[model samples]
Target: MSNKEQLYQERLNRYMTAMDCGKPDKVPVCFGIGEWAIKYTDYTFQEVFYDSEKANRIVEDMLPDFDVDIFSGGPTLWWPPMFDVMGSKLYKFPGIGLEEDNTFQYNEEEYMKAEDYDDFIANPTEWLVKNFLPRISAEFAEPGSYRATIALIKSSAAFAMFGAAAGAAAQRWAVEYGMVGQFTGFTKAPFDTLGDALRAMKGILTDLRRRPDKVLAACEAIVPHNIYGGIAGPGADTRFPCFAPLHRGAYPFLNPEQWDKFYWPTLKAVIEGLWAKGKRMFFFAEGNWTPYLEKIAELPEKSIVFDIDTTDAKKAREILGGKFCLQGGIPTTLLTYGTPEKVKEHVKRTIDELAGDGGFILAPGGVLMGDAKKENILAAIEAAREYGVY
Candidate 1:
C-alpha cells in the first residue's frame, strides 16, 4: 500500500476497534471533510465534481497534511440522485460553492398536481423501475461504475436541495406521493426508503400530536435498516427537529410545548425504534438537544452517539456518561475565528476532559464549512494527534 493508504488503514482500524469498545493503539482522530478543505486547497468545487483524478488528489493531499484517521469520500456535501430522477432543475453560483441551496428547483406546477397521494405513489415507483433503475443499473455495469454512480447520486441530491430552486421535485414527490408508504417501508428498507418522506414542520408536529401512531409506524419502518448497523440514530444537520432552527421561518410558529409535543416524540420514536432493532446510534444533536436530554438519555446506554453542537459539552458528558458515545464538542466557528494557539488549547482540554473513559470521537461539532481558516484547522488536527493519543 502507498504510505497514505497505509496510514489511513492503520488509523481506521484503530477507530473501528475503539468504536467497538476495545483498546487500540490510541484514540484515533477523524474529521468530516467539507468545503473548508476544497477552498483551502487550490481546487474549485466544479473541478472536483467533474474530474475524479483531481478529487482523489485533493483527498490524498489532505490525508498526510491533516493526519485524519478516516478519509471521507469527496463531493462530501452534494445532493442525492432522487432529485434528478424527479426532474428538478438546478442553479449554481460560480464563486460561492455547490450545496443543497445552489443545486435544485422543484417544478411547483408538477408538485401541485402531484398532491394526489395514490397517483404520487404510483408514478415514482413506475418511473424508478422503468426509467431510473435500468439506466442506473446499466451505468453501474460500466468499469468503475459504482463509484461513478454514487458520485452522480450525491451530486444530484446536493444540488437539488441547495440550488436556487425551492427544493428538489423529488423531495416534494416523496412527500406528496410516497411519504406514507415509504415511511411504512422504513422497516424493510430503513436507509433507502424510511427518511425519504418530507413532512413540513407543521405537518410533522401535527402528526406527533394527532397521528402519533402513524409517525411511530414510520419510525418503525425505518428501524429495521438501522439493525444492519453503521452509525445509528440521525445527524442533526437534516430537516429534523434539531436542525429546524437553521432554516428561516421553520419553527417561529411553534411554542416549546408544541415542539416537544410534536418534534420530540417523533425524535424519541426514531431513537427507540432503532435501539429495538439491536443497533446503537450516534445522534449528532446539532443545536441543543438539551431541551430533550433527559428524554434522549432514556435510550439504551452506549447505543447512541450524542454529538452536541450548542449545548454544554461538560454537562452532556456528565449526564450521558456510559450511555452514549460522545462524538463532538469542538465548534466549527472557533476553528474559523480562533487563533492557532487557542484552537490547540481547546482541543487539548476537550480530549483531556472527555477522553478519560473510552467513548469519545474527536471531530468538529459539525462538518467544516468551506470558509474555515486553514491554519486554525491544521492546529486542531495537530492538537488531536499530539494530545488525543490515549
Candidate 2:
C-alpha cells in the first residue's frame, strides 16, 4: 500500500478503537478548518459559501499543515447556491443579504404554525413538501407558478451536485491527505426538526405551554424520518457515526420535566432505531447537558460518541466513559480568546483528567468561532500529541 493509504488506515484504527472504548497508540485528535481559515486567505465569506471548488481547494491547502487524526469538517457548512436557487429564507448568506465578509445569519420565523400541527403530524413528508416548503422558500410561495417550478428544479439539481462534490472531496481527503472524517450522515433530534426551522424557538416555547400534546405528536411524527436520514448517506456506511447536532434539549432550554416529556423520547427513539441498523450517533451535544448525563447513559452501550460542550467532563467520564466514547475537551472559547500556552496547559490537563483510561478523542468542545486564533489551535494539537500517549 501507498504511504497515504497506510496513514489513513492507522488514523481510522485509532478512531475505531477509541469509539469502541479502547486505547489505540495515541488519543485521536479531531480538527477542522472553520471559517477562521478565511482570514488567513484572501477569499471573502461570500466567495467560499458560493463556490464549492474554491472551498475544497482552501481545505486541501490547509490539510498538509494539520497533523491530526480525524477531520471534523471543512470551511463552508452549506453551499449557499442551493439556498439561493430555492430562495430559501432559512439563512441570509454573506453577499446576498449582508456584507461580503459577514457570516450568514439565520432568519428564524414560525414557518410551521401551531394550527398546521395536525396536518404535519398526519403525514410529515407530505406536510413538508406541500406546506413547509412554500412557507420557507420565497420562490415557492405560489405553488404552481412557473417561478416555483423552476426553483424546485434548480434547487434539486443543486442538492445533487453538492452531494456529489462533497463525496468527491471526502474521497480526495482520504486518499491524498490521509484524513478521516469523524462521521458520515447527518440528522437532528426530532424536536430540533420541529423547533429549529419549523416552529422557531419562540413558537416552540409557547407551544410547550398552550399546545403540549401537539408538540409531542409532531416530534413522534418526526422520529422515523430522522432514523432514515441518519443512515441514508453514501453506501449507508456504518464504520463511523452519524452527526446529530442536538439543540433545545440542552439544559434550561426546557426544564428537566419538559425535556423528559418532549425532547428525550423521540431523540432516543431515533438513536435506538439507528443503532438497530448498526449505526451510531455523534451526539454533538452543543450546550450544557449537565442535568441529563445520567439519562443519556441509558442508551445501548457504544451507541454514541457523546460530545462535550458545556457538559461537565468529569461527570461524563464517570457516567459514559466505558460504555461510549467521549469526544471534545478543548473549549472553543480557549481557541478564540486564550494564548497558546494556556491552550497547551488545558490540553495536558484535559488528557490527564478525561482520557487517562481510554475512549476519548481530543477536540474542541464546540464549533470554533471565525475569530479563533490559529496559534492557539496549533498549540492544542501539538499538546494533544505530546500529552495524549497512553
Candidate 3:
C-alpha cells in the first residue's frame, strides 16, 4: 500500500479495534459533523439544510481539515424544509421557525391526548398512521384532506430522488477521502420514541407524574416497533451495527425506580435484540448517566460502546471499563470557547481516564455546534496522538 493508503488502513484498524473491545496502538477519533461543520465553513443553516449538492461540497472541502477517523453520515440526513413545509408542530427549524442562526428546537406539546393512551397502546402502528400522522404534518392539517395526500406523495417522490443522489455523493466522497463510516443502521430508545411520538417531553413528564401506568404501558407498547424498526431486525448485517442515541432515561430526569420501570426495560429489549442479531451498538447515553453505570455494566459484554454524555468519566470508566468500550466526553463549549491549550488538557484527562487497557475512542460529548473554534477542534483531534498512545 502507498503511504496514504497505509495511514487510511491504520486509522480504520485503530477505530474498529477499539470499537470491538481491543486496544489499538493509539486512540482513534470520530469526527462527528451535524450541520455544525457546514456552519463552521461559513455556510448558513438554510444553505446546507436545504440543498444537498452544496452541503456535500462543504463536507468534502472540510474533511481534510481534521485528523479524525470516522464520518457520521452526511447532510442528506437533514430535512427541515420538509418539516417546515409539512407543518410539523413537533419541531421549529432554524431559519423558518426560529431565528436563522438558531438551532432547531422541539415544540413539545401533546398532540396525543391522555385519553387516547389506551387506543395508542392497543395498535400504535395503526393509530400513528391514521390519527397522529395527519395531525402533525402541516400538509395534512385537516383530516381527509386530498391536498395533504397529494403533497405527501409529491414530497416523498422528490425527497426519494434527492436521497439517492445525496447517498451516492456521500459514498463517492467517503471513497475519495478514505474515511470510515459509522453505524450501518440506527434506532432510538423506546422511551424516546414514545416521548417523541405520543407524548412530547412536557406531556411525558406530566404522564409520569399523573398517569404512571399509562406512561409505562405506552413505552412498553412501543418495544416491538423499536426492535424491528431498523437493521436490528432479523437477517441484517451485524458488521455495520447500529448507533443508538438515548435521551430522557438518564440522571436528573428520572429516579432508578421510574427509569427501571418506564425507560430501561424496553430500551434493554431493543439493545438485547440488536445484540442477538450480532449488531454492535454504539450508544450516546445523552445526559448524566453516572447513577446508571452499574446497570449498564450488567449488560451483555463486549457488544457495546457508551459514547457518554456530560458525566464524570473517572467514575463511569471505573464502572464500565471492562464490559464496554467508551467514547466521548470532550465538551463542545471547550471547542467553541476554550483555548487550544485547554482543549488538549481536557482531552488528555478524558483519554487518561477512559483509555485504560483498550475499548476507548475519542470524540466530543455531543455534536459540535457552530461556535466551535477550528483551533480548539484541531487540538482535540490531535490529542489522541499526543497523549493517547498505549
Best by TM-score: 2
> RMSD of candidate 2 to the true fold?
0.8
Clashing pairs in 2: none
Off by over 4 Å in 1: 1-10, 20-25, 79-86, 89-197, 202-261, 264-278
Please give the range of 10 consecutive residues that has the lowest summed lDDT in model 3. 232-241
Q: lDDT tens string, model 3, 1-390?
A: 665467678877887788777989988887755655665566677667767777777777777775677667654366775665566777777677777667667766677988889999999988987778777887877756787877677667766766577558656755677677766666888889878766788888888889989877887888777666647332265665577778887687878888888888888888887787677777788778888888888788866789777877888788887678888878877888899998898888888777888888888877676667777877888876799889
lDDT, model 2: 0.93
Local accuracy of candidate 1 as per-residue lDDT tens digits, 53-102:
55546655554455566432343334424333322232233222355223
lDDT of each: 0.50, 0.93, 0.76
* Cα deviation of 362, candidate 3, in Å: 0.6
- Backbone atom clashes (below 3 Å) for every candidate: 28, 0, 1
Worst 10 residues of 1 by lDDT: 179-188
- TM-score per prediction, in order, is 0.63, 0.99, 0.92
Better of 1 and 3 by lDDT: 3
RMSD of each predicted structure = 11.4, 0.8, 2.4
Model 1 per-residue lDDT at 246: 18
Off by over 4 Å in 3: 1-8, 39-42, 73-77, 232-235
